[model samples]
Target: MNSTRMRITTIAKKELVEFVRDWRTIVAILVIPVLMFPLLFILFPLLLEAEAQELDELIVDVELQADDLPDGFQSALEYSSINLTFAELDAVENLTEPGTAMEKLRSGEVDAVVRVRANNSTWQYAVLHMSTSEQSNEARSRVLLNLGEWEQNETRNRLVAVDLDPDATLNPLQWNGSIAQGDVASKGEQAGLALSLFIPLVLAVWTFSSAIQPSIDMTAGERERGTLEALLGLPCTRAELLFGKWLAVATITAAGVLLQIAGLTFAIGYLATSDIISAPTMTLGVVALLCVAVLLFAITVVAFELALAMRAHSVKEAGSVLGPAVLLILFPALFTQVINLDGIELFWFAIPVVNVLLALRELLLNRVVPVHVLVWMVSSAVYATLAALYAARQFNREDIVTTLS
Candidate 1:
């Protein structure tokens, strides 16, 4: 066993040397994960907030079309942030034309058009703006922002003119709204919902992509470069050679996963609430679960990819087979998001990639079921070991010398 380990270690190191020599591998495994989380979590939100502020202060040109304007209608319009320009109805090309007002709004001639028609004591209003246009949406928001205040103020004026009590009428049945409190989850836990859905989606692609070039380069690529023949000449058993190469791939993939987790820790720390950290118990457990699930999944993915790579006649063939395989994970990952965890069946835990993703989401949400985790790990271990063994067996075949398959 010691001799086997030694041979494996030696082979693994040799493969790692190639990784270290390649700058792209270093960047993919190290730098990208470090930089990605902050840009996604921190920088993007700040940009959105800045844009929202700009929109709030924007001066929108609004065209108002109201029939028989009320006594204090202009005064109520004053409460709105929109710059009420009051463009004429005849300014339109045709009164009978369908969507004439909408056409002007869509063409950017007007930011928004407000139509107010009074019937009995009710005033029905519609704000017309192009949904595709940001400025138009902003203009519509500005008009609607103080709608309640406008109604109250106009009602007060009308009531006073008719010598009636507006307050009594408005306060006839005032009710208050309060959120129902149950099953309080920490902000970290709440954040986990989004984290699980989106994080796994991105990580799946990253993990697969990170493993691909290296796995292919070590397999079919080595065959292309005539290195496989030389490597095959070594006395080390096929299992030892496979172990070494797999360890090298696993090391890079594991490093990328660890760095991503660390980056996630730091980036999520920015959004931290509830005692400068999440619940200590939950956080640590979730982290442990994530490591186990993801590492096993990575092991399985890399093993299968390496096996497929060895079977391919060339690097291009391997890529064609592997690239679109992401859809297999993508479809299930998307499906799991809408699925209620409470109703999930135990059989799901036996599935390979899907099991890890679901278990990952549960962990992130701080919902750790021991049975689920155990099943996922055990099943994943089985798949990963089988995949690795299959890859090693490919090396033992007589046809492995050249791309005969």
Candidate 2:
């Protein structure tokens, strides 16, 4: 390596050693990455599934009010975890009257109320429940499910009553489902779609986290400790010193990201071809895109962090400035998750974090266009360069002795 590269390396090595010495930092940088993916993708989903099953198995009390019931329809109301209580005539009349049932539902007099009355020649059914109540919602679901079964059974009975075969006469529609991929291509893209859903957010968030300590500690921490002043008195120019420290912070942040990606890879491997990833994907192209995106994203974030950190006199102050910065990554990631990519305008690539997110999603989805990749790289590089220049300029001021130049 040249003298400049060698100097940067020396500084980076020192920073990494000091950072790794702290057990808590080690856990944040190393352990959390390995553990986070499994917990987020696996344990969380399992808990939600358990909650759903619990809801399905719960016994909810419901009051049934029926005036003219269809033949054998009441017998079909048995698919859910509901405790049925036949309502008295006065109670039935009060429930069907209108505003009174909602009050009874809110007051917990019943989990849900079901009403069936004659609509001229046919039966009309209604399920009333408090939308805010978990129990009431469950009861409502059960009632709807029972109604669905009864409707089907009643239709079949109607055909049988006409001396026709219920199976042949009652059902005429035929349907089946499969994916519509126009031609045979790598299923890898579909797999990337699932992974891409979380990876962009992961890159933005963890990249911020990984940069925080090293960036703040190198600048504010050193200044507060009086080491920065003495170090500035060395033979190197302000640019060299600034570059060296930036290199160190970037290195540590990248290392942490790699560890986190390794953990994410392990979790993905464990879940490959499972329900979580029905179309597992891996290719050299996918790997290439991921690395490019990660590096570009890291460059922009590290420079931003270093610039802010250099201006702060204390690590706490630097932290406070950069803490809410994570939300900059978070909300966009969430918003982009729900947006239809088909209508995404070309101008979106000009926005910073949002650009990275869109690029990652598109790249991972194998919708790569050469122009889009070029735009992402060019914009990111320009942004990174500007931020790095600003950070380096901080050293030109009397920053070694004071917070401002």
Candidate 3:
């Protein structure tokens, strides 16, 4: 037993050395994670905010016949972000044709055309003809906001004239939404809600992507380089060889995931300091639980990757198989995030990948049922064991080791 343990440890150390030396593996395990999460989660938001501000600088041209507008409506439109102009003297005839306003919208001649007609003593019918272009949408939004304010002011004036309380008249229904904990969510809860949907999927994808090269290179890559025979001829058993390779893969994959988490945390802190976003609620306890979950997930992924790599005779062949496999795993992980977590059926915990994602979702939401943790850990361990055994059995075969087939 001591000799076997020593053999596995020796192999694992050697694999780790090789992993650290490979530039691609080093980048995947270190540099990419440090850059990717921050760029995606932090820089993207800043760029998007800048783009939105730029969109606000656009000047929209809108045509309106002010003569027929209500007393305060034209003034309200003038105060809006849009530039309102009087339609041509023959505008009525032109507007009657099909697609006339739409054609103008397409040609960028105008952003919107507004027509208003008194429908009743208390109501006015307004038609806003606009394209789906960004400028037109912004124009429409501005017009709507101004109209709503005008309507409120008009309602208040009418209420005052009738000697009635404007607030009472406008809002008879005192309905408001409140969370069970309070009227507003605490900062931690708010952060959890924002991140719960996305973080699990990101972690799962990173775990798979980070492990792919290491797992394949340890098996098929070595085979393609004609080094597998020498390694297999060592006195260690096939199970020890498989376990060591898998351990190296899992270590690299888990490190990649943790590095990404660090990046995400740093980005959150930077954004929060810049007042661009709130800090995420991943407390030390929460992070510890997350790391445990990620460890289990990485183990399963490593074993699965090793199994596929063992089947393939070359690095390219392993990649062809594992790429689709990663996609297959990603779809299910993402699917459970949008599903009703509160009402998740017990059977979901019995499944392999589904349970891990669901468990992550619950954890991010700051709750974890004991049964869920038990089921997730137990089932993942079983799958990892089975997969590892399958890969070891494949390694024990002379044909798989000796042939390109």
Candidate 4:
């Protein structure tokens, strides 16, 4: 037992050294995860916020005739943040056109056109026309909000004239919402719900991307370099050799994922400092669940990728096989993001990549059940072990070992 342990350790150390020496592997593992996290979590939101601010500051040019304007209408427009610049309706250059107001709007000379027309009775109608541009949408929303407020106030005044309480008629039902009075979600918990859908997909892709290159380089690259046969001839058994290579891959993948988690935490921290997003409450239990999921996922991916790599005749062929495999794993997680998680069946927990993603999502949302975690952990372990055994068996095959052309 001791000798076998020593043999595996020796092989693992050698694989680790070889992996570390390859600067390409080092850069892929370190740089990509670090860069991707900030780009997704930190920079993307900041850019969106900046664009939204710019949109908020837009000056909307509106066209309306002074004679058609209602009393106190301009005062109502003054209450909104959107800058509403009013111009005469006939100022439109195309005066002969039947749709002159629409012509000015379509020509981009005005953001929107507001017209109020009254029939023979007291009822009047207002029409707002604008294109579907971002500035136009902002102007429309602000105008609609002010119009809605005006409508409500007018209704309330008419109700008072009829000797009726506006509140009783307008809001017949009223209810206050609270988090069970005492049970409230922490900022971290709230952040988790917001991130629950996205984080799984990101981590899934990160795990697969981090594991594939090293796994291929270790298995198929060695075969291409004519060194795999030499290593197989060593005194260590095939299981030791396979385990060592898989361990090295898993180690590297887990390291990259850990760094990625740290990077994401830092990015979220930076965003939280702006008070735009709540800080995730990363409890020790949550961290443990995440760590375990990452470790299991890495092992499963490395073993499966190593198995695929072992079948390939060259590194290029291995990449061709594994690149699509990464997407295959990634798409399921993304699919989960779109679908309702509550609707997912228990059988999904038995599906390899899908299980871990769901489990992690549940953990992030602080709604994880112990049985689900157990099921996921057990299923993943079984799959990983089976994949590792298959890789070890492949290493022992005479055809695979002797196929060094």
User: Residue 192 in model 1: shift from native, Å?
Assistant: 3.7
Worst 10 residues of 4 by lDDT: 89-98
lDDT of 3 by residue, 86-161 (tens): 7632335333343356677778887877666554666443445555688888877777777889988998998999
Candidate 3 regions exceeding 4 Å error are 1-3, 88-99, 120-132, 175-181, 271-287
What is the C-alpha lDDT profile of model 1 across 153-185, one tens digit per residue? 877888989898887776887655644244376
Model 3 earns a TM-score of 0.87
User: In candidate 4, which residue pairs clash?
Assistant: 188-280, 188-281
Number of clashing residue pairs, candidate 3: 0
Off by over 4 Å in 4: 1-7, 21-24, 65-67, 78-98, 120-132, 176-188, 271-286, 335-346, 367-370, 401-404
Q: Indicate the residue-level lDDT of 32 in model 2.
A: 84
TM-score of every candidate relative to the true structure: 0.86, 0.85, 0.87, 0.82
> Judged by TM-score relative to the true structure, which candidate is superior, 3 or 4?
3
The lDDT ranking, best first, is: 3, 4, 1, 2
How do all the candidates rank in terms of TM-score, highest first?
3, 1, 2, 4
The Cα error of candidate 4 at residue 249, in Å, is 0.9
List lDDT for all candidates, in order: 0.77, 0.77, 0.78, 0.78
Candidate 2 matches the true fold with a TM-score of: 0.85
